[model samples]
Target: MPYQWPTLTNWLEQIAQPFYQQGYVILEQAIPADLCWALYQDVQHQQLTAAGVGRQGQHQLNQQVRRDHTAWLNQNNPVQQQYLQQMAQLQQDMNRRCFLGLIDFEAHYARYQQGDFYQKHLDAFVGRSNRVLSTVCYLNTLEQGGELLIYNEQDQLISRVQPNAGTLVIFESCRFPHEVLPATTTRYSIAGWFRQNSSIQGRIDPPQ
Candidate 1:
């Protein structure tokens, strides 16, 4: 049977506590193993495009700064749709507890080849970007490196998250400056963001 989500039973309370206190939460193996494996299979077969930075019109691919291939999750994929549905539930629960006003979500599969690393950067810029929360779910395990290093306001390192398969990491988009350390092996994961509804003049905040 396909495992249904929101199965943490007390997920709302569990996710809310840490998020409210620290503006972040990590849920381990939150999605079923079968789903994770299925998504991994899709990534193995899909043709990922060069990952870029910035918005739609201003996007750029700077290999010196970051090197990763990405493939956007498509709803036509049953596994992806299942994951999205669970995330939708999580969005609702988060809004209820944190009053985040999250309108929707967007995610993509990211593959970081060996030696590929992302320089320190913030996912959101408070009044500038609409992305409120950032999420990364590891799709494969690594023996060494490819760890996520999160920094604080004083430029001090706070946490080092290992890229363990089935591990889920969530954090505030604007508060943390994070980077991916070069790995000895390829790293696979799903990167996503929860956004608030901030539209004006008929243009969406992110515009896709």
Candidate 2:
């Protein structure tokens, strides 16, 4: 069967409620198990390139900061399209319930090799990008390590998330400072962001 998630309204009642109460929300089995494995297989066959930090011209490879290969999601691909469709519905529900005014969604397949890790950082800074919410959908289970740690605005550790397959993690882009711990083994996931159309200070939302 094709990928399908819970109804938008029902899903929000359950998923978004916790999201607002806490700084983040985790949805187990958000994506079908078969779909998760398929996505993992897709990444295995994809020609992933070194992921860079920042956007466009400022984007540069900083392996020391983040060591992962990535491939941007595109609608041309069936699997990616299906995954995106699910998120599109999520964006609509988010807007209706939370009034986020989300305009678009972008995602990419991220694969972290053994010993890879991403330093603590914020996904979006205020008045910088349109990234309102950040999300990660784990495609494969991490054997050991490769945990995600999110910190509060005060820089205090808030929650630790294990890389469990078919789990979706959602959090505010600017509010939470998160990092991926060292990957004792390879890890596969889809990382994405929900964007708004409006920009601040006459600047583009994001140059990506």
Query: TM-scores across all candidates?
Result: 0.91, 0.91
lDDT of each: 0.83, 0.86
Model 1 is weakest, by summed lDDT over 10 consecutive residues, at 1-10
Model 1, position 51: C-alpha lDDT score: 82
User: Model 1, 113-134: lDDT tens per residue?
Assistant: 9898998999988778888899
Clashing pairs in 2: none
Candidate whose lDDT is highest = 2
| Model 1: how far residue 37 lies from native, Å | 1.3
Give the CA lDDT, 0 to 100, for residue 86 in model 2. Answer: 84
Candidate 2 residue-wise lDDT, 61-119, digit = tens: 99889998899999999888889998998898889878888888999999989888999
